[model samples]
Target: MIDTKELIDSGDLELYVCGALPANRAQEIAQISKQHPEVLEEIISIENAYQRLAAGLAPDHNDETYAKLEAIIGAKNKVVKSPSSWSPYIGWAAAGLLLIASGYFYNANNETNEEIVQIEQQKEFLETENIEIESINSQYASTLQVLSDPETVKVNLAGQAGFESSNAVAFYNNEKNVTYIDIQGLPEVPENMVYQLWSLTLDPLTPTSLGTLPIEKESYNELLRIDNAYDTQAFGITLEEAGGADAPTLERLYTLGVIDKG
Candidate 1:
């Protein structure tokens, strides 16, 4: 079985069908095939396949190519006095026709390639649009869930002494332990400055830096998600340097609010 498979893979079968195999190798294969039915069957299949292929691609030179050239030559010989003069004209006409066909084929191929490139670009655009739609749907689902929760704590941070009109609201979920901030009431943040959030403890007056609020993002419902603190006594927003400060600047406090447990 191994020998038969090797013979088939090594192209010995094709050589055998074409009568190109040496007599000694051919005799050895004949003996091996008599002992193995599979080998004989493989050789038969290869021969049949080659025969069919040859038949399908058989040349039609007699009727198509040779016949046309013969007729043209006969006409030139009978009508023209000098063979050289008429022959050159016939050759030039054939060359001209061939050049025109080549040009048409080249242009058609380029147009096909352009259409394929356009289709691929449109496919990529559609995929990007679909991803954006999925992201929008996911954001809306999250915002709706947060808003509908009854146990959610909503705290309005009023403007501090100096910044009387600038304000914002923070929504904290007790069970999920997450917080969302609404920045619509806050003023525009300066390029070099950012707003920092704090979770404060009134007794002894301690503040833990929650993180800085992003100036740029508010999802579906104009709500920007932020950090959460479980035992927070109050929440505050202050103008700080790029990254944020360790402690809130007393004078730069923008909004302050005490969380009412009741």
Candidate 2:
């Protein structure tokens, strides 16, 4: 029930990538990413970005530099007896002050770099979200146009004998040779079975298959578009095996509707 898009937009994924998220929260994200491919893809993209950033900013150093750095650190750690002169003491104090200032500026610079990375991530997310929104809006507009067309015929499919509660609606446009079915009221399909549509010819009692409905539960309420150029007198939906049947299974019929020629 978690909204993946909202989670991605919440900036938690970026924190997760940076290892800044709490252990429990990080594990939750990991589990969700397994269930949702888009989330996983985003996580990978963020990691790649960080890798590229690190590669670009990392200082070039070899074993010799590391050895030199270790020696310097060892030298600093050696006990130094207090000198009689005040001049040396003043010089040591000045060096300590300079070190503190350098540490402060280095921390500030790191904070600024982190902020830049976050801003870039936000910009990318926004652009992606905007494109998805535009694509969805365009689809809605097209669906509205098809439903509003005067040539489109609306057919209501009532529940069959055993399926008293199942219902669905279909918008068929003969001129456009397209059909969209709204099956929001249909019951959840059983496992290993699929809902198949049939375009019927009453005169000869013939049924032409119009393909199968998607098995996704999330898509049940959405309008399912099917190509139907057949001269159909009635429409029927039936539960069939996974790959669907060569013809409608009368016993498994869930909903039925007849078109009015008059």
Question: What TM-scores do the predictions have?
Answer: 0.56, 0.62
- lDDT (10s digit) by residue, model 2, range 1-262: 5699999999999999999999999977976786679999999999999999999998886767765776778733322233233333445778775776576566666666766776777799999999999998998898888899998889989899999888888998898898999887687888999999999989779999999999898787468888999988889999999999998999999999988776
lDDT of 1: 0.77
| Candidate 1, pairs of clashing residues | none
Could you give candidate 1's per-residue lDDT for residues 1-262 as a string of tens digits? 2477787789887898888999988966765675478889998998899999999999754545655676777732221122222333445777775776676566666666766776777799999999999998998789778867986788889999999987778887767777787776677788989999898889878998889888673421267776574667788999998999998998999998888889
Q: Which prediction has the highest TM-score against the true structure?
A: 2
Once fitted onto the true fold, the runs of candidate 1 whose alpha carbons sit more than 4 angstroms away are 1-98, 215-222, 260-262
Clash pairs for candidate 2: none
Residue 103's lDDT in candidate 2: 64
